[model samples]
Target: MKPVSRRTLDWIYSVLLLAVVLLSWGYVIYASTVAAQRQLRKEYPDKIFG
Candidate 1:
């Protein structure tokens, strides 16, 4: 059996970390936007803007 190269491993690790961070940030942003919208709706009743 052959051992994996360090450079390749490093690249894969970096890509995986980047994907995780991006997904987490995307979720956070989505949640924040939803919360903001909800707050706005609560603060302003009878307003059709969202």
Candidate 2:
């Protein structure tokens, strides 16, 4: 068995961090779009479909 090097660990950590950040941003954008749609529907139900 061999221990992992510092550079490899840092690379892994950075990749994981970037993935988390990207996922978070994706979810935020999706949620905002859904909220906006809901608001528009609530405010103008007829106008939305037409």
Candidate 3:
């Protein structure tokens, strides 16, 4: 088997890093939204939408 070239390795590293950053960002937003909803529900248990 042949070793990967430096340029190919750089590209792969860049893509992986970008994917991690994007997924982390997306997860933060999703988690915050869910947390907010939970808080709202707790604060307003009698509300229908909550």
Candidate 4:
């Protein structure tokens, strides 16, 4: 079989790596938002729900 092309492999690797990094960052951002919301709820319990 012919050897894999470096350009193609590089592109694939970069895309997958970028996807992973973006997903990780997304999770971090979502978690922080959730934590902030919880904190706000605690701090303004009546104003928010009343």
Candidate 5:
């Protein structure tokens, strides 16, 4: 097998960084939505419906 080139390594690193950023953003949004739901439930305990 041949040695990997610097450019290829850079590309792989960039893709990994992008994936991490996107995943973090998604997690933040999901967490915020969950927090909002919890707050809503707390403020309106009797109004939650399935």
Candidate 6:
């Protein structure tokens, strides 16, 4: 089998790095949304889906 080229390796690394960064941002957004929902529920016990 032929060895992998440097350029191909760089591209793969770049794609992986981008995926990690995107996932991190998504997690942060999800956590913030959950926290906000919890806070709303505490503040408005009678309201539904606010």
The best candidate in terms of lDDT: 6
lDDT of 6 by residue, 1-50 (tens): 89999999999999999999999999999999999999999999899864
lDDT of 3 at 9: 97
Query: Can you give the TM-score per candidate against the true fold?
Result: 0.86, 0.90, 0.83, 0.81, 0.88, 0.91
The lDDT of each candidate is: 0.93, 0.92, 0.93, 0.92, 0.94, 0.95
- Report the C-alpha lDDT of model 2 over 1-50, residue by residue, as the tens digit: 79999999999999999999999999999999989888889999888542
Clashing pairs in 2: none
lDDT of 5 by residue, 26-45 (tens): 99999999999999899999
Query: Considering TM-score, which of the candidate structures 1 and 6 is the better prediction for this target?
Result: 6
lDDT of 6: 0.95
Best by TM-score: 6
Every model: Cα RMSD to truth? 1.4, 1.8, 1.5, 2.5, 1.5, 1.0
Worst 10 residues of 5 by lDDT: 41-50
True lDDT of residue 42, candidate 3: 91
Error of 3 at 26 (Å): 1.4
lDDT of 4 by residue, 1-50 (tens): 89999999999999999999999999999999989888889998876642
C-alpha RMSD in Å of predicted model 6 compared with the true structure: 1.0
Instruction: Give the count of colliding residue pairs in each prediction.
Output: 0, 0, 0, 0, 0, 0
Candidate 5 residue spans exceeding 4 A from truth: none
Model 1, position 19, has a per-residue lDDT of 100
